[model samples]
Target: MKRDYDIIVAGGGLAGLIVASSAAYYSNQSMKILVIDRNAIPQQGKKTVSGWVCGDAVGKNTVDYMADRIKISWGYPEIEHPVKGVIAYSPDHETGISFDGEGYILNRQLLPQRQLRDATKAGIEIKERVALRSLMVEGNSVIGVEGDDLDDKTAFKKTAQLVVDCTGVTSVLRTNLPIKSFIQRRIDRDDLEATGRYIYNFELAHEDKTYFDSDYCIIHLDQKLAPGGYGWVFPKGENKVNIGLGVQQKAFDTRNRVMGVHPDLKTLIDEYVEVNPVIKSPRLADGAGDEGNAWGTWQVSVRRQNDCLVANGYMLVGDSAWMPKPLDAGGIGPAIIAATIAGKDAVEALQAGDTSEKGLWKYNKHFINDYGYKTAGLEVFRRMLQGLTNEQINYGMKHFLSKMDIDKITKGEHPEFSTVDRLGMIIRGAMNKKLAEDLKYCATINKVLVDHYHNFPETPEEFSEWHKTLTGHLEEAFALYK
Candidate 1:
C-alpha cells in the first residue's frame, strides 16, 4: 500500500513549521501533509538559542498567528529602551554612529513552536525524531521523503506528491536531490566566524510607550584584533541578551584558503570580555548545541549543486532555500515573510492540480521578487563595508550614517533606516574617497543584482536573461574592488 500526501514538508523549523501549519489551516481539507522533524513537537520551552541576532524572531504577522498554547519567554525584561542607534568602535577607539532602525530584540525561540502547534491544529501530522536520511524521487520529480526513525533505528519512507525542503543551511534533503540552484558557496575561515554568546546580568536604558524597546547590534572591524566580521551584542529585553560574532567566510578562507579553521570564537570572546567590562558576559555552559564550541555556532552559505532550487513538484523555503540575507546572514525575517507567502502559493498550486515543476517554481519567483532584492543587494554592501578600515568606516559613517533617518520614522518609537538616505550616503561616501571610488563600480553591479532579484521577470527566457545579466553585473561589481 502506498500512502500519499498532498504535501510533505521536511525539517520542522521556522519555515517548515510555518508552511506546514499554513497548509493545514488554509488548504488542509484535501491536503494530507506530513512533517518529519529530528525533534518532536515544539522547541519553545526546552530549546535554548543563546546568540541569535534578531531579538524578535517572529514578526508581527507570525506572532498574531502563533498558537496560544506555545509559551514565549523573553531573554530580557518585557520593558526597556529601544536602542535608536549604534556606536561603532575603531581600532584606536575611534567611535562612529549607525542608525539602529526601529526593530525589536526578542528571545526569538518562542514563535517556532507556536507556529508548530498552530500547524498541528490545521491537521499536519508530526513524526517525531524522524531524521531524513534521503529523498524519494521518481525520475526527475520528487515523489516523497526517506528517513531513519532515530527513536527506533528503523527506516521509514513517507510519500507525497509534492515535497518542500524547509531544512536549514545543511539542507540534507535538498542537497541529496538533483535540483540546481545559484545558492552554492562554501564558507572559508574569513567567510565564516566563530560565534559565541553568553547571558549575564544586564541593564536597559532605552524604552518607549506600548512596551517596546530597542537594543544595539554592535559591530567592530580590525581583522587581526576583531576577526573577519563584526561583533554584535543584541539586547533581549534588558537584562537578557543575545550577543555573538558574524564574519565573511572568504575573509578567513582567502587569508588562509583553508577550511576547519576559524577564529577561536569563544576563547577570543572570553579574552575580549575580560578586557572590556561593559559587556557583562554569559558563561560557556549557558551556550546551546553539542559542538566543540559548546556554547553556540551557526554556519552560513550552503545550497544544492546548482542554482536549481525549484523543480517539478518541489520548492525549498528558508535556509533550505538559501533565503538568508547574504549581507549579515539574517534569515529570520526573510524566512518568515517568504515562507508565509510560499505556503500560500503552495496551497494555490496544489489546489490547481498543477503541482508540476513549473507550478512549484512560482514560489521561487514570488520569494525572489519579494525579498531577494534586499538580501542580494545587501550582500554587495556588506562586502564593501567589510573591506574598509577604521578611517574608511568613519568616513563612510560620517557621510552616510544619517542617510538611514531612523529617528524620523515611527515617531521616535521605532527608529529605522530609510532606503533613500542609505543610498545617498553610499553615493556621497564613494564620491570622495579613492577606495570608495573603486567600490562604486560594484554599486551598479549590486543594483543589477537588485534589478534581477527585484524584477523576477516571469518566463524561463526572461529569467535566464536577467540571471545572466545579474551574473555579469556581479563580476563587474566585484571586479572594481578586486
Candidate 2:
C-alpha cells in the first residue's frame, strides 16, 4: 500500500511536535512525517482562541528525560522561570507540603515557537491551519485523517502508514474515530475540569511565601475557593506569575448552592486573584512573551490515561489519551513522557512492518509500567481529597501525612499506608476519626491500583480481563468516595 507520509501527526501542539521530533530522531531523520495544526503558522500550536491555555509548569526531570532521549532541550525565554519545587498548601494556609521536585514555569506562547523550530529542523513537514476532524479508517485500522483547511472551506485529506493523535482534551479526531477499540472515545463530564488562568506581572504587597513565591510553585487546596480542584501560583519571572484555578462542574454546582452564589470560572478566578494579599496592582502581562497568551481557559482531564493507547494503525498521545496527573491536573509531565515513548514505539512498530493492534501494543505496556502506574492511584486519592472539607484537609495535612508520604508524593509515587501509620492516626484521637479513616482508605486503595497498573497486560488479548479487574477496583473506590 502507498501512503502520503510514513507518519501523520494529527496535532502540532507540545505533544505532537515533541513526538514527531522523537520519531525523526529515532528513525535517523529518515521517516516522512507531517504535523498538522489548526492554528496559523505564527501561532502554530496555539491551544485555544484565548491563547495557549495551560499551567505551563513541568518538572526538570521530565524535561531532562526528553532531552537525553531526543536531543531536544529548551532554554532561555522558552523555559521562562526556574522553580525549586512545588509546595501545596492546606486550605487554611497554615501548612505546606513539598509536592514535586525542581521544575520550570514555561513561556507557553514562546515554547511553541521553539518546538516548531525543532520539528522543522528534524525534517518533519508542518501544515498550519489544518483542522483534523476525523480519522480515515480502512477495515480495523486508522489510515489517515480528513478535515478542512481553515484558510478556505476546501476539504483536506492525507494518508499515512500510522496516525498519532496529539490533539487536545477535546480532540475531534479522538472522539469521532471510526473504529472499535478500548481507546475511550468520550471522557465523562465528571472527569473533566473547567480551568482558567491569567499571566500577571504584579507588585509585591508583602513577603508572603504562602501566597506568592518565586522560588517555588504554590498550590492552594481550598474547596470553597476551587471546589473539587485547586488554585496555583506558578512563577513566570521575578515579578510575574501564572495564576489559575480548576473546578469540577458537579462540585462547583454543589458549592454554589451551599454558598447561595452563582459564580462562573471567570468570576472565581478574578476573585481569587483579587484576594491575593501579596500581589498588589496585578495587571495582565501582555508584553513580549505574553502576547496572545496572557489569559485563557481550557478543559483538563483528571483521570488515568486511556486503558488502551493503540489499535491497529492508530495511537493516542498526550491529552487525547487523558495523560494528565490526576492529583494536580498537570498534563505537561505525563505528556512529555507519553510522547517520547510513543514516538520510539511507533518507529519500532513501523520497522517491524506491523502497525496492527498486536504489534503496537508495546507502547501501552511500556507507558503504563514507566509512568501510568501511578496515575490511577493519584486519581483515587484526588477523588477522596475532593470530598473533604477545608477543615478536614487542614487536619489531614497536619497530622496524617508523614515524611515518607510526602517523599512518595514528591517522587510521583503512591504513598503506602502501613498498619502503624493507620494506628498512629487512630491514636491521634476521635477529634477527626472520619478524616483519618478516609485517608487510610485512600492510601490502601492507591496501593491496590498502583500494583495492578504495574502488572498491566503485556498483550492486547489479556486487556479485557485486566481492564475488568481495574474497573472493579475503581468502582469499589468510587463507591466508597461517594
Candidate 3:
C-alpha cells in the first residue's frame, strides 16, 4: 500500500506536536507529517490546571527551542508561573518542610497550542475531533492508522511509512500492537496514579492574610487523604492555584470500600479543602464554586521507562511510552526529550530508506541513556516511599532527606551521598531502625538498577538478555517493599 504521508502521529498532545515540530525542524521541512487529535486544540484559558516541574538542563533547552519557534515569551501569565520553592506537609498536617527549587506551574494547554501552531506553520497537517481506533498492520509492521472523524462519524484510513503513538495513558494504538512486540502490553493498575484536580481562585477570609505563599508550591504527604500517593497545591499565578490528590488504584479502591462512599478524587479534594486551614471556602475560577467546576480526573502511568519504545515501522512517545517520572508524576520533560529524539530518528530512518525497528533503534538507545537511567532510581525511590507509613515519611523528611537530595532526584539524577553524608543519615536513621533498613535497601537497589540501565543493550539483538537482567533487578527492588 502506498503511504499517504511520511509520518502519521497519533494524538496531538505535547508529545505529538513536539514530534511534528522537531521532525520539521531537523529535517529542514522535508518530511510530510499529520497529527490527529480526538479533541479540538486547546485555547488559552480552556485548559486544566497542571504544572511541569523540570530543573534539568535538557528540559530547559527543549523549552527554549520551542519557545523560539513559537514566538511566545516563556514565563508567567503567558506560558507558566515561575516557582521558586515547595513546601511539604506531613500526614498529620502538623509538621512541614520547605525546600528551595526552581520550576514552573505551566499553563498546560497554552504551550501545546503554541507548538501546534508552529507545526502547522511548518506544513504539518492536523485534524481535530479525529479519534484513532487502531493501527493498520501488515505482517507485524504498522502501515498506518484507522480512525473516526467524530464530527461526521465517518471512518477513514490514512497510511504512513511510520506511525508514532503519542496518545496518552489510554493509548488505543499501543495496546493493539502485536503481543510479540517488545512494548509492554498494558500498564498495571498498581503502577497508575489516579488524580483529580481543581483550579481555584482563593477567596481569602481576610484580604490581609493569604492562605499560602504564591512563590512556593505545596505538597501534602497525607496518605490518609491521598492514600499511597500525595496531594499538591501548585500556583497557577498569584491568585489561582491547582489543587489535587493522587493515589494508586488499589489503595484508592480499598479506601472507597472502607469509607462506604464512592471516594472519587473530587470527594477527596473537597474533604481536604473544607477542613484544611489554608484553603477554606475557595471559589472556582470559572465562577461555579457552588456547583463545583471540576477540571478533570485522569490516570498517569508512573512505571519505569519502557525498554522498547520502537517496533517495526512504529514508535511510542510521551505517556504512550510510560515516561512519567515516578517521583511526582512529571512527564513533560521526558516527553519532550523523547519526542525530539523520535522526530530526529524518524527523519534519519526515512532518509536511510529503512524504517524498521532496527532502523529506529537509536531512539530507544538514546532515550534509555539520556532519561531512562535516572528514572530507574526515582522509580525505586517511589516504591520505597510507597512502602512507608505516614509517620515514617514525616520523620525521614524532617531528619535525613534534604532539599538538595530531592532536587537532584527530581531532575533525573541520582542523589550523591558522601561518606560524611551517609554517616550522618545513618546516625539519624538509628532513631528509626525500620526506616534505616528500608532506606539502605532502596539505595542499594537503586544503584543496581541505574547501573544496569547505563549498560542497556547497544543493539536489539542483545535486548532479550539485557531485559532478563533488568526484570530481575526490578523484581528485587520491588521486593524491598514487600
Each model's lDDT comes to 0.55, 0.89, 0.73
lDDT of 3 by residue, 228-325 (tens): 78887777667677777778877767767876878667788788677555665677656312123336677787778777998898999988989988
Cα RMSDs, all models:
6.4, 1.4, 4.1
Model 1, 54-159: lDDT tens digits are 3232233333333321222222332223454444555545554454444444443444555565666677787777778777877766778887888789988888
Model 3 lDDT, residue 412, Cα: 59
Each model's total of backbone clashes? 36, 0, 0
The worst-scoring run of ten residues by lDDT in candidate 2 lies at 417-426
What would the per-residue lDDT of candidate 2 be over residues 1-482, giving only the tens digit for each residue?
69999999989889999899999999999999999998887887788889889999999999999999989999999999999999999998889988758898898888889998888888999998887788898998999999999898899999999999999888888888888787888999999999999999999999999999999999999999999999999988879999999999999999999999999999999999999999999888889878878889999999999889998899999999999999888899999999999999999999999999998999998898779988887888888888988988888788777788888888887766454365663555464677667777888888788889888888888999999999999999899776
Candidate 2: C-alpha RMSD to true structure equals 1.4
Model 1 deviation from native, Cα RMSD in Å: 6.4
Reference-based lDDT, residue 459, model 1: 53
TM-scores for all candidates: the values are 0.77, 0.97, 0.88
Model 1 compared with the native: what TM-score?
Answer: 0.77
The global Cα lDDT (0 to 1) of model 1 is 0.55
* Candidate 1 displacement at residue 416 in angstroms: 16
Worst 10 residues of 1 by lDDT: 408-417
